[model samples]
Target: MFDLEQYLDMFLDESKEHLENLNRNLLKLEEDHSIETVNEIFRIAHTLKGMSSTMGFEKIATLTHKMENVLDDIRAGKLKITTAIIDLLFEGLDILDEFVKNIEAEGKESDRSIDNIINNLCNLNDVETTDSEKDSSSQLQDDFQYVTSIAQKAKDQGINCYEINVKLEESCILKAARAFLVFKAVEQNGEIIYSNPSTEDIEDENFSDNFNIIALTKLKKEDFKEKILAISEIKDVTIKDFDKDSINLDQVKNLTVNTGNKIQQNNEQNIESKNDQSESKQRKGKTSKTVRVDIDRLDNLMNLVSELIIVKTRLEDIDTDLKGQNMNEAIEYLERITTSLHDAVTKVRMVPIERVFNRFPRMVRDLSKELNKEINLIMEGEETEVDRTVIDEIGDPLIHLLRNSIDHGIETPEVRKSLGKSEVGTTKLIAYPDGNNVVIEVCDDGSGLNIEKIKKKALEKNIITKEQAEIMDDKEAAKLIFAPGFSTADKISDISGRGVGLDVVKTKIEALGGTVEIESEKNKGSKFIIRLPLTLAIIQALLVTVEDEKYAIPLNNIKEITSISTDNIRIVEGKEIVLYRGKTLPLINLGNVLDVERKSENNSKEIIVVIVKKGDKDLGLIVDNLIGQQEIVIKSLGKYLSGLSFIAGATILGNGSVALIIDTNSLFQREWYS
Candidate 1:
């Protein structure tokens, strides 16, 4: 009577975890082929099989079971690990992954044919068993010999060895659950040495109504049968003494032969195992010491912090009015408490970037093989943490960057060799926390960005005016790749030539309040550096006024604040420009950009300019006045005000006024200056 829907989330989560483990370990196995890696993969497959079987995902369970067998054969040294074997295992892993994805998306596995993978695995397993050093007879003899040894040991320890046959009703549902319960019941009293049709087959429900287990216990045959039959849905129970004389080689061989037939029959019936609530509870007890808090709950907590901001603001106002030392002291204490609380909440929202990094190695492996290039992807600082919301988004952009590197940055083995470089190109994904931001760098050791080729491509695509291209430096030319529909590839391919990747990387990163920059040297290498804010919820902002309107600029993006005489500003190419530190800085009037009302003209001799940076470029924003800095909580302007240029979001001021937060990254766009 267990409801499968209730445990669907747990099932999907565990399935994803197991798939990640399999992918990581399989990649390791491909390189090392160590016994430990093989064992770990086998354990993962076994657990996935059981979980999928219990969840009634027949395709997933079937595929994982086949994977388990092959891994087992490899573990037993019956099969030698080879490139072909590893590739085949990866193929099976892919199919299982697809099945899990299908189940996750549609609440049931896709009808995609897994027969090819299953047959391939079976062929491999068959080759190991029938063509190994030990023949089929020897394998059976080994099994019996091991069983005989265990039985002899049991007898010497004054324990009775009995073969217990368990039969379920023909109409029984959830045979796996029933069998698991029966196993649990018997194991509570004794140890199970072996099971006909194999314990794996029974757990996967790849068996008929009856299965037999050999048990070493002090209980008599009648007592064991009585205990087993006491359970519901028990059609019958039979027990017999276990000894060497009872070991029938032909019978065991036939049982092994018929297991495939039973699986086929069961699959035909579309039999699904029902969820076992008790087993789910057992799993819950053994989980790691962490809770999966709903994201909505975290959002609620953040909202509460926003409310606390209002309280803190009101306290500051009271302190200002009372003009007393005691009031000031109370406000200071509250400030400290609120600061600590904010840090605690930010830490709670932070999660390791490892979750995004783990999937890349497998991707790199696949791409290297596809492009016929040799790439060694090195990842570092995977333990660096970012806000959970950022973690969810940052993965796709990283993928696009890595894929772009593999396809466009890294050279093929032959090309690399001819260039007098090592055949294997290195692509590194590095991440680290820097101040209030996280910096991720995707670097490659290959042919660097060809500035000339980029300029040529830009001209051909009309992405840059010839006049501008002629005057552009190598650094400026290299950035042309990020322009929409700009690519240097000679021919179009599935991987890159559509010229959609880097632009997406730019747009998405900027949307997340982050910035992307490229550093490249011709004939050397290229590195794409992305800087992202640690959290999007709250931040330190420099509040500025333009006319009567107020705006918040992220403090991290502000390089410096300075005053410039009106005479220093010059009109260049129809743009207001100022020379700062010998560099021509473009100036944008914040009041004009936001269309704020100018109540009166400013007659001041000096203009207050806020210099903000995006990547290597800087722009000066002219504001009416600076209101110092404040810790502000960013609230979304919601869908109605979404896609508003220049305004990233809105924040509440201490005086209960709403100030728009500036999207500094957007200010660097060419359209903004134009």
Candidate 2:
């Protein structure tokens, strides 16, 4: 029996890659109707068809086969590339994706969308202005596979064509290992001319227990089978002698080169094919390019480097004490090495913002159509780099902010015309480095924000008292729009305002030690500026002590820790309000929050208040004492301890004790009652 798992994974992977490339090429075909893009699109569809059929995903294979034919029409110049055709192609991709996801989730194909896309594809392909042209097209389709007329001269000269099928047991632990054993057995018999699953997948263990192979074996079929089954964990095997055209046809090359010889062989073969040569040239032509990496690896690497950075900072601190002494030379040398290491390691973790930006184009286009508005989205500062940990959490928040901008910020076409603004709305997404953080701004030129509507909504929710709403600062009220389940829409649209409010976006960003601030005008548009740290793996934190307990507050949130006179701490509204910078700041006694003892009888000049701000809201964190600031590696509280209310994450300091990093937003909420 065949091992189905490898084949299924191969099916899923090839389908996804094909879908991505199909989308990219479809986008390319729109701008430039070059023969290259059409051919590229055709190749992707062809691969998808083959993989789907082999995996027994008949619906996917059938639909993609029709899609491939239509693309062939484009490539052969029978059909011109148009937006309608592009839309059809995207529709096909979406259907295929939906089916692939169904297989992933439900372990079976989804037929709901397959028939609809296939019929549309058939109609699109079958269209003709006249009967003669349709006949001419049908004749060409019959002759489409002509490229198989390959290497007759080389083959008839005693080079026999062979097709080999190898199947492993379903209970096999390593299907790829079995595949490799089969590969070795085949090479011992003759050269493997072609493989159905592709060569890279064989090496990558990207195949099922049962894979088909076509080789030009010098030995007879029985000889090949005997050698393969002799291996341990061997199941069953079959070898067939194939026809002539299949012999010299270049099989799909999907092998990851392991040795220098394999790379050299591929390079030589690449030199022979103009298409291969051109793709290499095109890749080299790109000034800036993108690479896909698994986020988990980046996370782990960032963590290890962050700890090193923390230790380096500690070494620097140690050097500070020895600065003017006999150890100055060694200290200077240490400083140089540490500084260089910091720069290099930090660069390793700094990925460009383009990783997040590339996902927006399709989103904006679909959203504009959904709203029946003409909206253009423009992005800038794609080269801005942030720490990898920060990049992972930034995507959803940015998307939510963009969605909010479209739903609430931009006015309808008629409203914009009535407001004397351009009928088409334009939004700008800007990201750039600011101080030690990256600021992402989503600014729209829609009808700004309806402040009066927001005030009324706030009053209804009882989030604010009517008197507070009457005196609420416009800037403060602007931030309220991000509150939980809040929306100013009179009637909910299909896109947003289904009670999945911007509060989730705010909460997510804040959880990453970032801040989301709202800025808006009444009619011009609104700008949601999200400031995120360059890297969350490590941060400059204020190490403070309340009683005997130690904690870290992000240095970004602290303006300064002002030592207040006990006289300045006056009671207001039955709460201890400290006067700082000429304003009353609600005080948070860290000793109380941590439930620790406060040993202080003399309050004359002993206490410290760290002023922290989130958006426009500020709070004074009163700790029993301020332990000196230090750079610390932030670690999560694992899965079980994540919901620890006021704690953001825990970090291990140099002396091996752990300190809980203060949650900036949570502390802000804590101050609401303090």
Candidate 3:
């Protein structure tokens, strides 16, 4: 028997991708009402319906069929697209997305109330309720004529025609697998001539607790029943010999006409067959070829490459000691190969940020309707690639950020008109590569951040001291929005003003070794700039020793390395500071901050300072030694060391010792508290 569970993961992945395409195409159809877009949607809907039916998901199959009818009518010029239809289609897509999620979690689509939507779809498209719902008798009627003819021919050849009805237990978990076993059992004793819901539908689990099959077999009826009963989870099985004499051709033709199965209609079949062939070719031409790989497999491959690099690094250390030319050359070759392999693995783990961006258009549309505002969302550089790990964690934070923009940043139409700006507010999400990082900027052309209001809220919430609030500049006050429980809204709604979102965004971003900053103009707008590393698995880092222990600082955060005399360091109000290139930079002693015991303090004549940039500002990190830069793979410190302050992760060095990766941004956070 075929194991349907083995293919469940593949089905869920493909269905999600197809559902995403449907949403994208439907959004396009709503915007342009183009024939080409409608055709693409029809093709996708048809494929989805076929897949769902084969998988035995009746709800998904029925709903997509209804949607297919409407698309069919629209493409045929029998109906026109309207706001109601667009809303209905979007509603269907949302339910479908939810259904897929449920399937992923529970291995079956959870029961959801879809009758109202299905009814609306049927009423809009002029399809009978029963026809769209796939009543078993009506569904069986579509194949009655064909089955009768085949059964008559079998009867003439001295073959017994049997109708097998299988009722599985209600608690059966793997219904599809069980149904496949039934088919296997039937085919072993006889040939399956026809089935009520079709073999594809049975395999897909489109039916409820029971399915029917008609077979021509030479075995005794008792023997066939015993074969099916041996399978597990079967509630009961009923076998009856089908009598061809009782099947009236006229009645079969009438039932066929009543059932609106397009394939049964004589002239429509030819036309539909031609259309199917044409669409098959079109789909073949337009389909984007891709495959899904298991993430665990990729992670295993990355670990292997990391091990190879560690071995190479060990060999390099030996080469320096032994001074063998041949060994040095071999090590050089190994280095080149490992570098290429690292690049290849990183590329494989890269995915376009568009995957996260695609869902926002639909969200913005719904929010605009709910808030009674006109807002246009513009996106740019959506094709920028980021590490898969980053892509997965960044989505919720970005969603919270966007929701904050719509709720707090954008003003209403009347307010915008009064302010001499366009009535429609604009929110733009743009991403691009900068140095070794990816920068995402979310900006809104609406009422900008109110610095005084934010400061007041910050003070009221006890997030900032009154003295600090009084001395803060506009930029400093705006940053207070990220402080815990800081919201300027007078009232809380479902959308925002809960005082919970931005803090989570800040924490999550910082956890990923990224930083976020806010810039605002009084009447113009506000922009939230988020900077994230390109990849998290492996990085170019500058290794430094604090006291006796070593740490790795990501090279992307370092601006420059400078040597300053101990006399050059200035003490201002008991805080260590240094003036570098016309800017006063605060200095943080790595040894003291991480609680490492120092051999001595400020005893050396020369001090090594590593300048790290956070946004437009710089901080000098005082270190004892500057180890050379190297490419290292980051490894999580696991749960025991998870909450270690200012430490991002740990990596293995050539000496087989673990060096904790420092999160430079967290150092700034520590100083803010101090």
**Alpha-carbon TM-score of each model against the true structure:** 0.86, 0.73, 0.76
Residue 512: error of model 2 in Å? 1.3
- Alpha-carbon local distance difference test for all models: 0.83, 0.72, 0.81
Over the stretch 406-442, how does candidate 1's per-residue lDDT look in tens digits?
8888888888888899999999999999999999999
Clashes of each: 0, 2, 5
Best TM-score among the predictions, by candidate number? 1
Model 2 Cα lDDT, one tens digit per residue, 548-630 = 78899989998778877777777777667876667778887777776776576535565788888887668888876777887
Which stretches in model 2 have alpha-carbon errors above 4 Å? 1-21, 27-36, 50-59, 100-113, 128-134, 137-294, 306-346, 497-500, 599-602, 671-674
**Clashing residue pairs in candidate 3, if any?**
54-204, 55-204, 56-204, 56-205, 56-206
Give Cα distance to truth, residue 147, candidate 3, Å. 26
User: Residue 560 of candidate 2: its Cα lDDT?
Assistant: 77
Write out the backbone clash pairs for model 1: none
Q: For model 2, where is the 10-residue window of minimal lDDT?
A: 254-263
